[model samples]
Every structure is written in structure tokens, then in C-alpha cells.
Target: MVISSDSQRDLFSDTGALGFVQILLAEMHDDLLGKVARFRQLTDLSKTLGPGGTMIHGGEVAYTAWTEARNSFIHGNYIATVMLCQSLAENLLAAYIDTDLEAEKLPKRVSFNDTIRRCVSKGVFDKSFSGELITMMNIRNPLSHYRDLEDPSNLSRRVLDSRLPAIAHLMGDASFALAIAIKLLSLPPFWLSGETLK
Candidate 1:
């Protein structure tokens, strides 16, 4: 990861000028923070997930992923931001279920969809919010799972204007991901002002 003159030389020698140019193409764009047109849709999201309060649980891994998701969105890595946001949601719900349910009552951690169902059934969150989480989950499934040509969710078959780029969709998806994450964090045991679960 350490960059040096030798590495630069090697990169140029291995890929030639064309490949080197391609590698930096995405990183050389306009200020990504400024490109985020949808972030202004919810300015108050900061009041929820911003760096003012302490997280109540011991899920550092999830928190780190959430941080990286935010970083990715700000830095123009929209695909990574969307995927990581879904991942953070899945992990956060799992962490809550592990803590709230008894060992005998719990089954395998299983799938994110299943986890969401269990959480709703157990009163972890209501159906309305679960619908939002489900949308996040569905958005991610198309990215991870390969689909046939007829599947609209398949990236290869998705409808788009011929002039538009994939990043256009990804930018919107990443923005929605961040908003959904804020909604999740703003709910229940995660966002108690001074109240503790008994």
C-alpha cells in the first residue's frame, strides 16, 4: 500500500500509459462530496448518526463498516457504499436479536431477510421500517446475485437511457442507503436518549 517511485515505475511498465490512466480515471473526478445531489434530501440524518453520542452496544465491526460506507459515498465509491450500507443493516439487526432473544428461542443467524422477519415478529421494529430495510436488502441482492437476461434487477438488463451511465443509478442507490441507515439507527434500543432496556 505504501507508494514509492519504484511502484510507480512498475505500474507504468506493467500496464503502460493507457492502463495507468484508466486506473486513476474514477479517482480524478470532481469533488464527490459536491456531486452528492441527494444528500441534502435529509439534513437531519446527522442528528441521528453523526459523531455526537456513544453507541450503546459492543459492535465495533458493524460501526466500522457503517463509517466506511459513509466514507465511500463521500468519496464516490457508490457501489461499495450501497453494499456496505446493506451489510451494516444486516449486522446491526443481528446484533440486536442476539442480545434481546434467549438462546433457546433463537435459531441460526441465517439470512438478512429471515433476520428482518424475526425482528419484526419479536417487536424489534415494526413492519413499516422493515419495509425500508427490505428495500435496502433487495437493492443489494441484484448486486451480489447473478440474474438471467430477462430479470429487470439484473444490472445487465436494467432499463436506462442510452446516454446515462451506471453511476447515475448507483449514486441514487447509495444516497438511499445512507438515509435508510439513519432511519435504522434512529429506531428503538439503538436511539434511547437516557432510557435503558430492562
Candidate 2:
């Protein structure tokens, strides 16, 4: 059967409820496809610098955790992502420091603060970078612990409220945490040999 021009035009026109619904669904599908494409790009970027290439001990685990943390942040799990990034920084710093210390001489356990101090003392990181890492830790600790507090009036909870301004502040802190994590991972002194550094 030969379809008339008017019939073909009517088929694609968004003039009725059904047409509106169909148009909405098509727009939603396009948006989802765009998101999926972006997600794939991020995943590829995350794997660009592999753990082995970084050369820190336990680098593999830390790199994997970083990728997961990045995914979490992209997926809107900001608080969890910040916490994971902070943990990754700690692990990377510890492993980097342990590289220079004898196995027997290493501490049984070290806190993040102690690890940062050791890194600074060993020249793995300078005082300024050490201070930045400490600041990131400070931001992560309060946010992470605030979720576990039982008291509704806790200072951390009050400061990190659900309001827009508070959320923006948390996002800023998370960005700093991620930036510090990446800096620690890619620091030339940590990854380079003596000859390379010189």
C-alpha cells in the first residue's frame, strides 16, 4: 500500500500524548547513551597508569582502589570516594616508605600521621607535600567518622550538613583529597631511581 505524505508526517509528529511519551523516551535513551560513552572514557583513563608502572610496593592494590574511588566519585558517592582516596594515599605512602626501610626495622603498625612524618623524614616527600597530605587526612577523617557518630549534634555532623553549601564544601574537600592521592602516586622522587632523580 502506498502511504500518503500526510500519513507519514502524522506518524512522526509529537502532537498527542503517545507522541509526547515516545519523544521523551527517545531523549532519555540518547542521554543514557551519552552517559555510557563518558563512563567508558573514564574507565580507560583510570587504567592508563598501571600499578606496576608506578613502582611502589603494594602499588597494584592502591591503584585498583584509586580506580574504584574515581568510579565512586563519578557515580555520585562523594563521601565514600573521599574516604577511599584517603586510604589509597595512606597505603601508597606506607609502601613507598617501606621500600627504604629494612623489613625487621619497619614498625609493627603505623598510623597515617606517623606515615606522613616518616615520609617527610626519609625525603620521600617534602614538608609542603606532607602538610597537604595531612590536610587531606584531616578532611577525610572528620567526614568518615561523622557518619558513624551516634549523637545528632556532633560538631562534624553539624558542619557537614545535608544542605547545598555543606555538600559543595564536601565536594571541594573530596577534590583536594583526590588531587593529593594522584600527586602521591605520580611523584617522581617516589618512582624514580637515584640516577633518574639526580
Runs of candidate 2 with Cα error greater than 4 angstroms are 1-53, 101-104, 147-164, 192-198
**Clashing pairs for predicted structure model 1, backbone only:** none
Q: Model 1 clash tally?
A: 0
Error of 1 at 11 (Å): 6.7
Per-model TM-score on C-alpha atoms: 0.72, 0.61
Itemize residue pairs with steric clashes in candidate 2. Answer: none
Query: For each candidate, what is the lDDT?
Result: 0.74, 0.69
At residue 137, candidate 2 shows an lDDT of 75
The TM-score of predicted model 1 comes to: 0.72
Candidate with the greatest lDDT versus the true structure: 1
lDDT string, candidate 2, 1-198, tens digits: 999988899778548998889888886576476456546644554443434455545567777778777776655466777788887987877877777645324576889888877877877779999889878877776665654545543335555565446656666666677677767766765453324434
> How close to the true structure is residue 191 of candidate 1, measured as C-alpha lDDT?
57
> Across residues 27-94, which tens digit of lDDT does each residue of candidate 1 receive?
65667566464345445565765244435343876888788887787777888888988878888878
